[model samples]
Target: MQPANLLLLTIVCVLVAYGVGYARSRSLAMPLGGIRHLKSLPFYYGARAALWCGLPALFVLGLWVAFQGKVIQTLVIGSLPQEMIPGNEGEASLLLSKISNVASGALPPSFVEAPIVDASERLQALREQSRFYMSALVVSVAVLAGFLGWVRIRPKVNARVQVESILKWVFFACAALAILTTLGIIFSVAFETVRFFDKIPITEFIFGSQWSPQTAMRADQVASQGAFGMIPLFTGTLLISAIAMFVAVPVGLLSAIYLSEYANKKVRGVVKPLLEMLAGIPTVVYGFFAALTVAPFISDLAASIGIEASSQSALAAGGVMGIMIIPFVSSLSDDVINAVPQTLRDGSLALGATQSETMKKVIFPAALPGIMGGILLAVSRAIGETMIVVMAAGLAANLTANPLETVTTVTVQIVTLLTGDQEFDSAKTLAAFALGAMLFLSTLLLNVVALKIVRKYREQYD
Candidate 1:
């Protein structure tokens, strides 16, 4: 059976187990006079039966799905003739791809070697056998476990305790999985970054002014020597992010203040949704808007004022990005401001403070932590944005602070470097990981700064 079909079947079994368990518990309870005589309720018994019927079967299914491909590939590779075996990981991967294509009927049978055809047949047979065994075992285990759970249900058995214990471990496993995934990403990026640093000097990467990532494939080739300087990329990223923040912070904050403190229910209802609609617009649409409208207007306006501006300037990208992130800051700030204790507002009013004065002293301070958090999130969003920048700001890694000059960000360069089919062993490809590591560190620093800001100003309410 297909995994999806098996999953559906397992769910049906679990539901049937729940019904059976519930009925059996009630039957036992009636013999004992009433459900009050049982140690726990019928709901607990049903839930326990369902958990038994589902959890073990699901665990086995997950393990099988996770490891089946690797096991099959290992077996297939081992079965290959000694001369037919690949010498390297890359070649092995290619051979496996071909085998998979042939097995799936994508490749013509007449075009391949006889050994490959045989291997493809073996792969298909093994897969069918594996699926057959998996389905039978999973179904048998589910039925047996369900029966055992139902039989074990007694007046003295504590089903609630067992179910809660299992759920607690499941939650812990989920949390651990997330942590492990993050660690895996960090380690993978770090390894590639180290490789990148080995190819290019650390000093050159960090302090060099130019940003060219093109490396010559051969020593005789007259291609760019590929300056791995990150300064230009960092400069462009910060310049655009600063422009975005300049446009976003004050406007978003003020709008939030108005909405929370002065705007009536009707006004807030109409204005807030309209403002948030900016967020719903796709970044690609914003990219088109930036490229088609904003960039040209800025260039024309700059030319009219006799101030030179690039047709694709950081101002266009940053301004549109600012508009994109405004709802993020406004919505989060509005929520935090409204969440401030009503008792504190009333106390300030009783002290003859004006509404504005109350907001300045009491509510804003209370909400400042969450506001800072929102702003940090917006800044991160601005930094990570690529589509708008790619369309509006040209991807020349120019080391200038001028928003009117065309420039590119670290993220843009990372995307450019990894855009095509390229070997990972190249410094050019590894540079993407190096850039990613830097971006990750920049975000981490922002989080640290936000925490410090919150700690310095956080208010406590009893």
Candidate 2:
């Protein structure tokens, strides 16, 4: 069984044991000579038993699974014929893999050898035996624990409280798992970035303006030195995000206003979902629409107006990105607007202010915090968006503000850096992580600020 499956099985076994214990205890404590329980429910006792049996066993199972592969490989290699072992670790691993495949009935003739074959067979048998023993042990422990828990149960036992406590722990574990996963990703990126910094100075990477990432093909081959200035990328991301915000904020806010204040049920029912549909459209589709439809149209329009325009102008990409963020901004703003207490609106109307006057003077100001929060979120999304920029925005990292010129964003640069042939240890690859780190920090900061503003505004409303 896969380790994940085994782990799941172990958990199920524990829960079953707990149920069994709980049921048995309740049955024994029955008032009459019938099956009715006198004390806690049967399931509670069983669950308790299951928890005791399953947790320890599963913990051991996880630890063993983590270390088993390396330990087993080492043991197998030590047992192999000395002559059959390859000189390099990589080659030896390949040989070991071939031997394993052969034992599993997938061995190729080129790697087939009598000693290796024998070793593979022995390893397979050992693994199978170990699995069988472990399974038996798990089952035995679960049953034993369940039986013991059953013996301990009484009419006075507070099964509900115990169950609640167990559930809380379970929830805590799930939350920890999620947090650990995020931490793991961060650390993985950070370590790789550190490795990259070792090859290239931080100063050069951060401040360099020219971003050509080509490396020398051979020791003697002439190659253009790669430039890693991130200004252009940052500029592109900001520019596109600005354009998107410009498109989204006003439209989204107005939509929110119409829906919350003016629109009747019939209009709202039709419009809200339609606006949400914008969010469901795949970004790649938006990318192509920008490239094929919007880009050309805008370029032609600009030319007719006596302005120079690139086929893949930032304006086009930014405009499309703005369209993408509109739903996000509107949906969030709508909720915020709706959340504003009706008392305030009623009070404004009672005071002789017109609907528009109340919305402009009282409601909009009150909902401004949430509206800004939504806008900040949209900015983050626009900054991080990759596929649209990759397709619609040109690869040129021009650090210019002219919307007519093409530009690239950080996400696009990261994609290009890691794509095609790449040496993982090189400056180019590492730059991707640094850029990612910066992006992550920036978004995180924005979210924090936005959340803080929302919280303060919420307090005011309350």
Best-fitting candidate, scored by TM-score:
1
* Worst-scoring 10-residue span by lDDT in model 1: 215-224
Give me the runs in candidate 1 sitting further than 4 Å from their true place. Answer: 1-5, 75-86, 90-133, 217-225
Listed in order, each prediction's TM-score against the native is 0.88, 0.78
Task: Give the alpha carbon lDDT tens digit for every residue of 429-449 in model 1.
Answer: 889999999999998888788
What are the lDDT figures for the candidates, one per model?
Answer: 0.91, 0.81
**Tens digit per residue, CA lDDT, model 2, 288-322:** 99999999999999999999999998899999998
- Full-model lDDT, candidate 1: 0.91
lDDT at position 240, candidate 2: 87
Output the TM-score of candidate 1: 0.88
Question: Candidate 1's error at 148, in angstroms?
Answer: 2.3
RMSD of each: 3.1, 4.9
Clashing pairs in 1: none
